[model samples]
Target: MRMKDPIPQFTDIITKASKLNLAYLHLLESRVMGAEDCEEGERLDFAYALWNGPLLVAGGYKPANAQRLVDTEYPEKDIVVMFGRHFISNPDLVYRIKEGIELGAYHRETFYTSSAVGYVDYPFSPKYLASEFV
Candidate 1:
């Protein structure tokens, strides 16, 4: 399922959505593309989809430099970071990040393990109001 250049007709996408002011770049399970070690801005913009590198490492948040695309001409284009796993576990992650709370490590055992052990056991940070009293 690999593609040499998966970006299909970028012109068509741009033209169709020309009236739209904002667009999101969804990189779905794109680790297979080996984009984990690149600089924040060295990735490709596949139509409206931007395939960037890894999300987090060890215990640090390595935010990609999406602002690099925002020059004087395209200053209106804002990049929104969409973390798949983090958002799935912590639905209120956007608020947590704003509050400067610690995000716990994910349970690797349940990544694809046919059980709910890791899936449900991963602890949320204290900032998570729903699971705070748990």
Candidate 2:
């Protein structure tokens, strides 16, 4: 006999923890909301969830679009934005976001490589780091 997967149980645990106000929920996806040309209602629902509680939204968020969402749609909610593809090419993503530096584009060819060529090889921003030395 095959054993059942534990994902449901894991989700149950997360749900219980969330109900207790012990953990914040984070949602992530490979594509941005509007990039796929999804319906307005669909996007609105995603934004609406932020008003329910603390949430971290990750996936294809660029600095400008993420800021626009926060500034216009969910100004009253607690939400944290994150980037994945951008991070692959910008190890100093958080600093770049803070300093208004342009992010480097990721190399799609090396994205799924087994070696470190695309993973840890991305360089940190020199200008941003240089400012710290002064």
122, model 1: CA deviation in Å?
A: 1.7
Model 2 segments beyond 4 Å from truth? 1-22, 29-47
Error of 2 at 54 (Å): 0.8
TM-score of each model, paired residue for residue: 0.47, 0.67
- Model 1 earns a TM-score of 0.47
For each of the candidates, the C-alpha root-mean-square deviation to the true structure, in angstroms, is 7.5, 7.0
Tens digits of per-residue lDDT for model 2 on 1-134?
Answer: 11264445545655565667645667653353433422121133333442367777775678987897778878987778877788888988888898899998787778677899988988888886697732
Which candidate achieves the best TM-score against the true structure?
2
Report RMSD for candidate 1.
7.5
